[model samples]
Target: MFMTLTADSGADRAETWVERRRPALHPRRSWASPEPFVRRPTEHNSGEDVLGAMPWTRSASGYQRITVAIDVVVALAVVVAAAALGGAGWLTAGLLGLLATGTHVSFVAALRGYERHNLGDGPAEFQVVLRSAVVVAAVLMAVAFLTPVQVPREAVLVGLPALVTLACAGRYVHRRVLHASRARGQAMMRTIVVGSTVSVRDLVRDLGTAPHHGYLVIGTCLADVVDDEAAQVPLPTLGALSDIPQVVHDHAVQVVVVAGDALGGPALRRLSWALRRAGAELVVAPGLVEVAQERVTVHPTAGLSLLRLEIEPPRRRLMAKAVLDRVLGLVALVLLSPVIAAGALAVRLTSPGPAFYTQTRVGVDGREFRIWKLRSMYVDADRRRAELLDRSDRDGLMFKMAADPRITPVGRVLRRLSFDELPQFWNVVRGDMSLVGPRPPLREEVSAYHDAVHQRLNVKPGITGLWQVSGRSDLPWDESIRLDLRYVDNWSVTMDLMILWKTFRAVVGGAGAY
Candidate 1:
């Protein structure tokens, strides 16, 4: 059969193509077919108004404007304060402040820190801000030695750190606000996924899991090989891959995610050109799921760009982590001793058992450690576990019951506040655990693990890690293990610090504690 490609909208009228095809076992859906495709309702197609409705919408350049304003204010306030406090002449201090602020902002801009696309998500934003700060510091040091002007020591010592801290804090606060907006479905980018049926479905599922990332999947376009499985995807079938351009235009899509090899080199390039004219961003997924940006670098060779994966040696950072864990763990243990004591006292008074609970948990290298916690359940809690197995709220190896009968009234409060885990700091100090690592698994849990899951045993389990910060008991068994394994394979000291910061927030919110 001969098929003449056509455009539905006047804007796409000038660009049209044709294809000759033979009927296959599974006939492809036509855009002009009287049957309605799986497109979203008219309300979902109102995403074109999402950014214009709000002054600070993430998809607009307003986010970048806010970021740059924050950076300028922070840099100026810190430098000017330092210069004035150091007793510099008014003119000198003013000039110095301007120079420093300009240099700092320029460095950040040079690093693409203020780009709207990089503003709301990922560590790249913070990483670039940090890099800019480091470069500014080195430049200031050069100015101090190589020039006649004497840069104030206080500015170097105080201003740089203050600038970075305040800038990063601003970014964090802005991100939180953006996330809140996205959760309410306010600032999301209208997204269309294009690939094979299974690939499109998988991408949709993963994207749905983290709505805060802001790509709202409105529908999907199947590749040339349409199959029965296409019906299983939750997203509506916009059309076949060849119809992506028209689909993007009709839906007013902001982002087009190309998954798998639905479009080969020339076709993908052509799609990019089409998307550019439609003012939509084209994101090609290389199918490397959950890989950290730090591990991947792009190398352009012979007119093609290849991704080079670099694995940092674990041993290089292990010693630093060990030292940090012991120092911070001991300090935290000392500072929080009174709170732990109060929790233990509460547990003891309310339950007919010791205040502390100890259990043997498999740790790094499959070695066992006596994990400690403030007992939040009755003495017979362990004995009653088998009886409650059928009623467990969670699935897979991990067992969690939202309303377990074994939990004491006091235990519920402790668990809610996460004070029950305070005794684990002592374990951290004792070198049995790190400040951040995989969740320590039960011996029974370890025994049931598959080979891939065993990778979690490579590092010492933590008092608080990705699993703890990311929904805790609310996460399913498979999800929890996936997070732990991701941490084991791609953790840095920076990631540990980020996890610790998030732990504080999670504990305070107490959303998924049960």
Candidate 2:
């Protein structure tokens, strides 16, 4: 129960003694349960001797090499393809093409596109791609006007856009591959969690919560308290903070994460030095959780790293979102008119109800609006809802049966493909909804909502959002709320587009369709 840390093998002997006493504390090398301190590799990174050596930096190195190869290939292909299409001489075409390609690569590099991405930080890379494209376009246009080089007009207009698309597509392919690799238990950092017992447990739970995040909690080195109760809490304590260097070397740790009041700057500096020798990077997980990276800007003032938080004005964002919703909504309505019509007819004939179902749902600011959908159930389906409440198998505030008898045969198919929701394009056009926002809450659902849930009302209800792309009816209520609230706080045009892109996949897969 008690151990003293000496300069040498003393710490190793103690850990061995502890592990022998509590074999359960020593998790098997394979992936284990979702609890903290499981010795199992997937208990957050599998295999200590083998997989612990599989650091993220190595995978990142390989990923970067592939990225470079993709960039070069895309750049060359775009230039050659554009030159063949554009009416320009070889010398002029080559010069302009190379210039555009070089400039974009440089811009992207400066924007940190090549940097390692955090897990769950969805699609932030695409924004960097767009910005780099804009800069390349502006520079090329300026050069054409200022000089007598005679740049090709068609090439500048069309080729530049094509180049951007190709580069982004290549990045997307690489990103997907990288994610897959991480999911398969490759590409993760061998992490040593250093903090108070509570902080280490919390961090383990948080880090372990998202397995694909690639932070493999191989071991722990606790802070402050010296009772060494870390093992009792069950994280494999590699002794005290003083034994960090030994632990890092022993486990081949690639990352050493400091949580809570673990070490002061001087102690951290010393720790960093020791970790550097072991080739491990140090990370500090501040207590502030779930802050969007976009909102936080780092400012160094008098040697202090200050986090400047930018507060977005609710009124301005909502106004801009309203405009986008109507414009896109009108376009969708026109495009999907035939599908909507067919869905309505199918519902009417099969369900013996009005073709269109319009129910009052709470929108932004608790305003009630008639949300439209093609009927997906019999005429008395809503009335029979009370009878099914006793037999509900649902998550949180949601009530959905995997196989509901109220659903008509046609309704089942409509719901499966989400064809019945097409009428909501009109709601989007009328400003009753948004292309991307929170779910339109039912009147009873809103009444049951707590104070924090009202933040969803700050923005208009969305048609396809984080909730839609995520498992719809199948997702737990808490997780659904978290995703919706995350969107509400961090909504952007790019985020909306990302959600829309993901929505297509979710719909096609029918992942959570009832």
Q: Ten residues in a row with the worst lDDT in model 1? A: 16-25
Per-residue lDDT tens digits for candidate 1, residues 1-514, read 0111332444333232222132122234443334433443344344353323433343457777888888889988887788777777667667777877898889888878787677788788888778877877787778879988778887778888888899999989998998998899877888999888878889999999898888889888886534566677887787777677657756777889988766555455556666655557788887887688777878766655678886654576878899889999999999999999999898877768899999999999999989999999999989899999999999998889999899899999989998998899999999999989987889998899999999999889998899889888889889898999899878887899999999999999997896
lDDT measured at residue 158 in model 1 versus the true structure, 0 to 100? 86
User: Which residue pairs of candidate 2 clash?
Assistant: 41-45, 41-46
lDDT of each: 0.79, 0.73
What stretches of model 1 exceed 4 Å from their correct place? 1-59, 225-230, 301-304, 310-314, 344-355, 408-410
Name the lDDT of candidate 1: 0.79
* lDDT leader: 1
Estimate the overall C-alpha local distance difference test score of candidate 2.
Answer: 0.73
- Cα displacement (angstroms), candidate 2, residue 109, comes to 1.4
CA lDDT, candidate 1, residue 28: 44
- Kindly give the number of clashing pairs for every candidate: 0, 2
- Top candidate when judged by TM-score against the true structure: 2
